[model samples]
Target: MGYRFHPRSRTIKMDDWIFSPVLQRTYASTEAHYLLLRHLFEGQPIAYCRVSATCNSLNVKARQYHEQMGYKYEGTFRKDNIARWGTPRDSACSSMLDDEWPLNKSVLLTYLLATNFDADGKQIRSLQELRTLQTRCSL
Candidate 1:
């Protein structure tokens, strides 16, 4: 666990984002990874973390887990739920965006592209080679 201080409010934010993953099964600690990715793109300072969303029909285990993480309902997505399942599922939704945005993702997705491989090891060849690979040369 670690903490970061805000310059203006002099507020102290404690975060275990990295370690959160290890303790995720208890709550959203497991799902925090996805949030981390989202936060990376949003580029905000995250003081707290969790790994679940109450927006869908998550299992009871997940619901309890999220509750333990200190996330309160911000709003309900009653319309979206009714538009789909309606009374059948009685599916309403909620969120916990208490702050505008938090967390930074200076290092997020790192994809290794075909554009960076050599002729010997890379499958990305010219259009002609692609056709050849599609068909077998064997009789």
Candidate 2:
């Protein structure tokens, strides 16, 4: 679901993280991705993590999801690859720096807590809502 690279450098590149369509909106993907990040960054020397997604209709939601997870968009790599259909596809790149990880980690942890959900399993507050509130409080 996720990966860590660059043992010598304080950086990791996450590649090929995908979840089945049935798992969407269930928080499985988000939790798994966060766990990978927590494992790599907790008490480790990692400082940056980069992730990229293909620029296509299918991946538009993925890019937005990455942003929701606190990744900052760097730019797009034009014609980064040729799809299996022989169509040129761009890649959107994003990264999360060490300085920004702590807050993100906190937000994720808070969001994942049982108290954040209701009896019906609906979220008491959305991730963005928590992030916004935490960011404002930290200032």
TM-score of each: 0.29, 0.83
Candidate 1 residues 13-122, lDDT tens each? 33222334456442234236446435432445543332224433433544443333333444334433332344533222223342412211211111123452365544
Candidate 2 versus truth, CA RMSD in Å, comes to 2.7
Off by over 4 Å in 2: 1-4, 43-58
Per-candidate local distance difference test: 0.35, 0.72
Candidate 1 lowest-lDDT run of ten:
103-112
Please provide, for model 2 over 1-139, each residue's C-alpha lDDT reduced to its tens digit, 9 standing for 90 to 100. 3455666665666644567888776667678878866766664454344333334434778788878888778877787667669998877777887678889899999989999889987889888998999999999
Q: Once model 2 is optimally superposed onto the true structure by TM-score, how far is the C-alpha of residue 72 displaced, in angstroms?
A: 0.9
